[model samples]
Target: MSTMLQWPASRPARPGDPLVDSFGRVHSDLRVSLTDRCSLRCTYCMPEQGNLWLERSTLLDAAEIEAIARVAALDGVDTFRLTGGEPLLRRDLAEIVRRLAALTVGGRPVEVSMTTNGIGLAGRIDELAAAGLSRVNISLDTVRADRFAELTKRDRLADVLDGIRAAAASGLRPLKLNTVAMRGVNDDELHDLVDLAVEHGAELRFIEQMPLDAGHTWDRSTMLTRDEILETLSARWRLTEVDGRGDSPAERFHLDGGPHTVGVIAAVTAPFCGACNRLRLTADGQVRNCLFARDELDLRRVLRSELSGTERDAALDSVLRASVLGKQAGHGIDDPEFLQPGRGMNAIGG
Candidate 1:
């Protein structure tokens, strides 16, 4: 598909006019992919080899990322999450965090967070926290060392565990663990994963695997649903649904009693399209309104154009507004005619 090209000559978007889509859902969260290179080759996330990687010259630099983020913040985006195939792969990651930390929206400081595999996080958690990283969501599917090696094609389970401890010690509050439950894979270890979370004082969330895998062979029959997860957990612990979840994707529950909680993201079974409030910027600078969106607006072109600073910022604002205006009602994963996106989860910045 061709990128959106029309640009408005107006000034930057006003704070009064938030980034709202056609469905009237105002977006305040922006997810930015720093790079597409990763250390681990997870079976579910990518192929074992022959994976295509973006050239460093094509990616948005730290300055460009900060500029785009500033534009988004000026439009009332209050939350920014850095993501990637593995964000730590970027050498300038700490610098990026420090730059984004200086951003604010509507007189409030912007919240900066990251979604990482936690392989290289242990040694840098202190530096990252000092750079203004507020929280981290680590992706860990199984607790068994053998299972971890089999699933990710890496023997970094010990590294990840140490990273979790380092994160806690570094004062990354409300640490979160994300697990993708696949039937007959790691589904049998749900309780064990929860126990690990409780032990570390981190909230664990089970996510229904979507069709974003590199294999493109995701079958609904083999997938585990949210109801089944709750059924299994309820057998072991008393789970009380927490009220007022707001726009967050996770449906939270208290474990046994107060002070400990778990969450489930039923993206396929229980869609939260009406309340969806997020926009994504690919590392190569394409703007995506939905994870399954086939269309993209090329903001990188604007950033690289010969336009003046004012003109470039104005063009970026126009592209951002147009992208949000074109947001779809839902990802359409449950629709009979649904098709998986061409890009894998790693490329799309999960």
Candidate 2:
């Protein structure tokens, strides 16, 4: 187990960097990676030879994460989600959630959420919910046991199902399931997911396979378009679009039967760059302005060393300043000639 470290006292915070995109969207959400480490080895998200793990000493502790969350809250970031290769791999994860849940800015509590691979969630879900987690998004690409093993190189389907059940039982209301639509792979499971959502009253979201991972060969034909998924799902159940929501990438729709919804996230084929409101903080104390960004602000030095409250606030200002300016109009991956940098999605904290 990793030893707990003391965090410096909170500093008087300042406004966060305002991200006004060309599409009239302001960035107001942040995804903080507690660890780039994960147990699953999904073929589309990782390379056969994975990335070197980040140094433990350089990682931002739970206190620092909450402190940063408070700073971002001042900047209009009210929603924060903890993500990782699989966030449950972090031993102090529940404690981290507790710290983040205790944070508030401008007299308002920030919404806390997490995305996990569901491997260890069965045992941890209740504790996490008790610690102030409002929602959870579990990654479940395939349902078939053998197919899941072949895709992730792991055999934990029963555990995954148990984790989902635990999340629901723990009152992680409206729990979401994320599945990446890979060509010829798991596309047939579209109806299966809809059935799960309909039966469990959970929201299942289908994501487009983007080209930002280490396994870089992307076949357009194999790519499942958002329209295709909707068309397939609508056949069985009628879907009505929901209204009055922030700039979420997913298009939410309600099932005809009752109070169930399924969302389609089409980041690649239908770019929502204009409405993108998310900023990323990697496990190694760096801020990523965009998913396809090649540069990151190194904040580990300040977090580790002795810096006055004013100095820390200055560092946060600098990081956010650099981040907003670096936001891209859109990921240039559509240009078939582009090459991606950085590690796979797992290493990059998807």
Candidate 3:
């Protein structure tokens, strides 16, 4: 089967417009994968040794990323989320962030944020913040060092904690911490994880584990549900629903005993496909309309081809538009015929 996704032959015609799908979903948020290389081997993300690393030559460079991002910005993409196997692994991240931050939309600078594992973020928080990184989301599954090692195959809990603190100190307040909700693993630490976030004025986000594991060993029965997570957190503290979620994935709540809020992504049980305004660009330059999408459009070919400058822009515009046009109404996780994606979360940019 061909990997390239074909543009709909029967869909309505609207060429060279904003990134809006047939469902009237306007994509204003762009998720860019800086690299597919990660430091840790999380149980829910990938196996100890599963997916191979993407070639450095294939991964988009700073200028390449900026060029594609510029195209999106012109098309009304106001915010860019830098994702990865671990985004900080890219040594030129600050420069990339600076370039992205410089992009203007409606006379305002386009937002640039990142989702990382926080392994190497401590010392660079200040530098990144200075270079136009608006905010950050760091993944910390467990607060216990032993459990962290068990979950992520790393004993870098101390380093992650330090990065969290440094991010807060650098004024990245409402610092978001991403926690993948596994059934038996780390489920017992909801309160402790929330406490860890509250202590540093961070938002603890509980993401229901999806079927994006590299090992493809995810059992639906073993996954934690959204209700189960709320039941546990509500038992510890009173949770008042925060208003105005908009298109944000995490459904937030105010912890009565704390100054900050907590969130739950609930990707599986409570999929937010309707309000999803996200588009993903893979490390190798394939644009995915959805994370679970079976197909993607290749932008690398159009990027490196012998098209003229104007022709290149037109080609990129078509690719970006087609990506959004192929949006699925929902991820269809509940449908009996639904199959897990071949690419894992690491390769899909989280």
Backbone clashes for every candidate come to 0, 0, 0
How well does candidate 2 match the true structure in TM-score terms?
0.90
Query: Candidate 1, which ten residues in sequence have the lowest lDDT sum?
Result: 1-10
Off by over 4 Å in 3: 1-16
TM-score of each: 0.95, 0.90, 0.94
Pitting candidate 1 against candidate 3, the one with the higher TM-score is 1
Ranking by lDDT: 1, 3, 2
Off-target runs (Cα >4 Å) in candidate 1 are 1-16
Tens digits of per-residue lDDT for model 1 on 1-350?
11122224475444336786756678888999998888888887898799988888989999999989998988788888999989988889999999998999767789999999898899888888889898999989999999999998989999999888877677788899999989999989999999999888899999998898877978888789999999999999999999887788899999998689999999988877777888999999999998888888999999989986877888898999999989888999878999888888888886
lDDT by residue for model 3 over 1-350, one digit each (tens)?
A: 00122337686434334577878777889999988889999988888875688888999999889989888888888889999988999999999999999999878999899998888788899899999999999999888889989988878989988888888788974579999888888899999998888888788999998888888888989889999999999897899898889888989888994467899998888888888889999999999999899889999998899996878877888899888888899998889998888788898896
Q: What is the lDDT for 317 in model 2? A: 62
Tell me each candidate's RMSD, in Å, in order.
Answer: 4.3, 6.6, 4.4
Better-scoring candidate (TM-score), 2 or 3: 3
- Cα lDDT listed for each candidate: 0.87, 0.78, 0.87
